[model samples]
Target: MSAVLLDHHRLQYLHEAVRLGSVRAAAEALDINASVVSRQIALLEKELGLSLIERLSRGIRATEAGALLVERFRKWEADQADTVAKLRELQGLKRGHVDIVLGEGFVSDLMSGPLGRFWLRHPDLTMAFDLAGTNEVVNAVAEDRYHIGLVFNPSADPRIRVATASRQPLCAILPPGHALAGLNRPLRLHELVDHPLGLMHPSYGTRQILAMAEAAERIALAPKLTTSSINVLRHFVKSGLGLTLLPAFSIAADLADGSLAAIPIDNRLLSSSEACVITRRGRELPHAAGQLLRFLSGQMRAFRAGEPAAKMKPRATRR
Candidate 1:
């Protein structure tokens, strides 16, 4: 073939056929007849003067020429999507959407206050928030799955760039009328070793930090109860099951309402955690998402500074 014009529909059929490993499957996915899909792929192969796929017993595999074309075309599709999203963003804040992913630890009064405030300002803008583990949040942001992410005690990840971070102290959460609630000073590590401990699962960053603190002090903390849910831990502590340790932001409302008392940790290793707002390193966020990112970062800083004094009502099934 000397030269060829790009036929978008035919190229789409070929891309789908390669992706699904069968023309019939691609046709089914695209809600079209199988013969049309097959014919389109044949035309694309003839124009390109290349055998684009190798038929297998069950399905198929893309040949070398097909693989390279598909890869470049996917990149083109991504760039085109980015360009369209940018265009939509220019219509003003009232019409666009922002997708956010965050860890369960951040479903707090601190978050709700800012979220509520922002939505009230841009009532028509759509927002989707998803909960994942800290590491998952980072990975999702790096993979461009979300416009922004919030993670507690986030570690260094080269694929992501931190937009803002606030140091959150890990505090001992004591139930109302618990013995330790009366203490004025920060709690020492050894002081907590004997308490009936309710803690988050070992996979949690907070729990990992607590473990390190225990190891440094030559003490092993056998938690009486362990759960993956921060809300569960909060409720357990509130019921006087046992003391639990978490970031101050996670339980700020409980502390304010006198349901739980927060005593700062004295150990340097366990003193504080970091809550960071992160985005993909090189990709520029859409205008609305970028606005929300800055808003969330400010809210984190405000919470760290102890600005919002009133008890904030929790909303929805958070985290």
Candidate 2:
């Protein structure tokens, strides 16, 4: 008997259908008709001689066999990309793509210097960045959807490997004239309670660290506003609506321009928070991604050692 062969196109259709939860959704994503997606998956199921999907009223789900196949296909796609990258390396081509997912907080530091300098060094290479919360960043990296993850105080995950980490404590951010801005020393968590507070949503790593500190110190924080956008939190404080806690690197430019002030928090857990560069465990990155990772490890302010608050002295109050 001849060896069995599975069509790559059929497998891709099945993978997208299961991933997107509907043939129509997959068709939209793949820019094809829903019937094409259905037909391709049907052919895949027939060729494999197994039930691949369970069609439901709401959407579709992969069967056990389908799930296994999808997993294998994902790994195979990652490997194929890696192989192409290696081939480019062998050809001494200084060109490839790197995909990175990171917390919104790191955007400033990344774009400030590292991104520009790296692009100058490798003009042919392309890069993409997706902004996500810490959990999303970790999951995207671990699932091989992204090549690198930049996060703060990431939870320990066996599937992730930290390339480098630097001490980046959480700091209370205040508008230039806020009462807390006058404090030359670390601010106590309790000091923030009476003031209006804006906070990142709980999905943010900064919020996670703050939650632990709140629990440890037995303090309850009630923020008037909760949002997922770092910009919103920054703007909330800058507009003097309220203060928020964040890593100094997140708003380095604001701190430097004296539009905002960052005061250290006098909590151990908050102080212990770190900025980390993470990648999937046991996976060799493409050459371009690996190079970009190393560049970020050395150049990004988040991964650099030093207290950002030291340079962020509160702007002297005017009478």
Candidate 3:
């Protein structure tokens, strides 16, 4: 093996080639000619005495050895970035980036205040906020695509470590002056079935739980309007079309301002939801992200402590 072949340039070329899956595509992405990219990859293979890629009609794919090396290189790159973040922390937290992806439900009043305060404390720090579904957020964090994740009712997986979690029960959302608005007790699942229903799409965390309840009771749910967006469900509810089911945090402001009525559900399966803050298992987060995570944990704790419990009627007949 030639010592020159172990340099950063050759390794970078190999990484790009595997990532883009074609020498020509890698060259285009890197703004270099195809010949330069192919020559470096050939030299790398010669030095290692192994073919790194297999050409195909459409593009190229990495050999097993090449794939393993690229995986290691990515981990090494992450470790180097962590080291730099730590060094910046010693320099007084002047500058760093925190990448966070959360469920769209969190974009509402749930996170606005705490995140605003976090930014105020570190004006020089940068953060990127992305909205995705709960499961997608969990997957993104587990894959190390983001430093922090906030999601609802995520699956039990070994790849993610939950830093803070709060159990939030499902609530029945009713428009102001609706017939059910005056009830202080928990509403039964059967009680809500007769009303016109506007449900979040099946992909949402709440809808998943609702589906379980429907099967458990041998009942069918016929939503008059189905949408993937929470805002659309809220809009439908506000227009007096039908009641929608949501976790309490999503309608906190609406309930507070007398615009909506939030009733707790009495059923066991749909009684509550879990809101979690997660990070990749065994991976140390960057300093900026870590600080924000701690702050978020505290905020969740305080919110849970201060939030009122669901009002439920005593169990008797199903109705």
Candidate 4:
């Protein structure tokens, strides 16, 4: 074989030509001109000392040797694709899709704060958001069904990697015209139970927060409305459905708009109820995900310190 015959460009042209069925089609698929593809294929055929493709009246067909070459090159191309995929997964800055399984509360409040900002930092990493419950998040991450998971006090997975993304005190979200719209100070948990409360569905992070509140109070309190959607919950609260408790950031817009008020719950119960970040243990986070995690860690310091939300690291060779 000639030194010039074994080039990647030539081999790539041949493979694409066979796969695409014609020189013009291959060039179109490869975003190159037909002449360039034809020239490269000619060079490749000359190097192999055989015609790989036959120009038929309509289009083209591969010869016997060409068919074999296609088979071999197809495997090589598949391997090349696998190599590219794995490399992209490693760099954490590759053009790959990420499926993020987080709770509805998280997608409502925290994602826009830290995670949204991280999207601007890394544009190549596209994220698909799935609003899941604590149980769902825990199960998906433990089973490697999702790339990253943001959840609450679910049992830890030995096979999962955990990080504390953000720690915000659960605050009360009251609809307009409610008696406790804006109190002078944070209301006590018992005081909160006095009114019919809106809570998330069972097994959700919000429900966990409610359970903790109930456990602290040592009583079972039924919710006025139970749901798995933050938007629906917010709408219910806004439409005078009932007062629900959520992270302060989650109700920021409603708070600002006078439709809802955030009654601070940074008490002992709130301190114990944390949205622990969880993922598959050994997997590396993408660039945006890592940056977002860093921002969450920093911003959440204020929460642990009992201060208000103010602002918005790596395990391996992450970029």
Candidate 5:
């Protein structure tokens, strides 16, 4: 009947309540009274003439409308932060924050040089890194929750844009004295069948690509160990428990230090896997974030062409 206008304060209350899953939790986060949050959200619902939240047995859940609103509010917050950062840039003030979500496999490469170099060049800029699987990385970037995403063999998504990509094939990681480590040439997928194998969880892009290769080669691989941690997989092999599959760049330090050996896989799909830097399809990143994205694309070992020097060496049997 009457024109309705939403209040920013009320929207914030609703956002926090939905995010934290309870009014009391939201109140604790905001350092306010629970009643205040509930009252404000109720007022927001009244104004919108729609229920924004539904109380569950233990907590609360946002209605579909509320979820949509919350998503918009999050995007609005991100845009506002980006706008302020851009304005600061125009004033020659070098201060901004960038958030990135990436697969664990990229951690070694990112920390080895690219992250440090970027930090040295832009001392005032801050960055946050969250480790996730490829699917989570894609969703975070697409939803504007993160500025950049580093993924391996990411699935095609209309909401994602590949900023840069490099061919970084998945390789079988073997312990120095392991039989597979003595292979002078690329290892075939079927060759790993009899060995104790460790694999990343199916959620990871690495596992997804491996699955495709298995299907293509008409071989089913049943790994003895399945885990979500990349480090765990590395350790699984290092302990001589089993061999695992990962990109050579993922274990560059291990390879260089002779702690592990990575043999290229012969599967066509495995060889075609690429490490990619992605962003939201049409989103304009902040100045600092954009610069970091470009820096990573050019500097990260995973995004660079060719294998690491350790992987290029001739394989030798341990005495």
Candidate 6:
């Protein structure tokens, strides 16, 4: 391959290789031979004057440079799709694609039931999900990352159309053996100041809620553990590390199983808020995004209807 040549195919290969971690697996996905995939990677490395990946015992790993390239190309791929969608939309086509950018929390719960059904009903639409923080969500949509983005506790932004999906109340996640494991009544935020707490990363929506609590009480919480995965945070709480603070819906499974407890925070620290669909100004979504939007809307409605806030009692399912 020529040094100046930039092939989207090569970019796709690198991205897939990174995600699947196996040239053979990636080749299988692309329906090509492993040797062909290896040759393409070699060409890519030669063009960049650096190895993009290394063969691991079980799979492969991207070099730092390779990782950066792959991430950038992910955006590039998205941009190409957007361009195609827009050009068609300009030519008497109101359908092309729908980019449904969402946070990890929404991915876990709101994506499947109703939203998935919506996708099935709309065959002409296509959709993609991007995960990022509030600022990134706003920026990406502003920069046309996807037709729409989901923002948690979204602040004012000129980049995209924002909507409120849900305003959930912050709650405490307690472990099984904890004395407060069975309580469902609202509790004060300051009450948890002394107890060990597990917190999410500063970039996450949950982190913003905790920050508000810290500012209101004029104190900072020194968590025993901090993480990105809400599930892992719940796991730590279940393991007796500490408690966590987030909206009631985020940990519905844990609460139902009695492995964790959700207690409302009465300190008025944060009004629980999370991601919702956002579309850029002057941007018309493709068939996929519109389908996804209706899907997500339905999902959110069903979520509100089926998942209710009830006091959970400690059950035998406690882990």
lDDT string for model 6 (113-148, tens) is 665666566556655777776667777776565677
User: How high is each candidate's TM-score?
Assistant: 0.72, 0.88, 0.77, 0.60, 0.86, 0.63
Candidate 5 C-alpha error for residue 21, in Å: 4.2
**Taking the tens digit of each residue's C-alpha lDDT, what string does model 3 give over 172-278?**
88876777766656777888888998887666678887888889988887898887787887888899889988776776666666777677777777765677889
Q: List ranges where model 6 is wrong by over 4 Å.
A: 1-96, 123-126, 182-184, 272-274, 301-319
Residue-level error in angstroms, candidate 3, position 210: 2.5
Q: Stretches of candidate 5 above 4 Å error?
A: 1-3, 21-25, 54-58, 307-309, 312-319
lDDT (C-alpha) at residue 5 in model 6: 67
TM-score of 3: 0.77
- Over 1-319, each residue of candidate 2 has an lDDT whose tens digit, in order, gives 2355978888899889998899999999999999999998998777778899999999999999999998778778888999999998999988899999999999999898889999999999988889999998998888789989999899999989999999887888888787776668678889999999999888889989899989988989999999999899999998878899888899999988888888877777887889999998978998899999999999888988674543565322211
Model 3: ten consecutive residues of lowest lDDT:
309-318
Backbone-clash count (model 5): 0
| lDDT, each prediction | 0.75, 0.87, 0.76, 0.66, 0.87, 0.68
Q: Once superposed on the true structure, which residue ranges of model 1 sit more than 4 Å away at CA? A: 1-80, 91-93, 301-319
**Model 4 weakest 10-residue run by lDDT:** 310-319
Runs in model 3 deviating more than 4 A are 1-74, 110-112, 300-306, 309-319
lDDT of 5 by residue, 100-170 (tens): 99999999999988888988999989889999998989988887889999999999999899999998878
Model 2 RMSD, rounded to 1 decimal: 4.3
Pairs with steric clashes in candidate 1 = none
lDDT of 5: 0.87
Q: Residue by residue across 1-319, what tens digits does model 4's lDDT show?
A: 5554267777778777876688999899889999998998787788888898999886688899777776566445544544665687687645665567877665545544566565566667676788788888887766555666777656555867777644566777776456665345556667776677777787776677668667876877677777777787788777765777776555555655666667665357664556677766655655445655566656533224344542200001111
- Please list the Cα RMSD from the true structure of every candidate, rounded to 1 decimal place: 7.3, 4.3, 4.5, 14.1, 4.1, 9.0
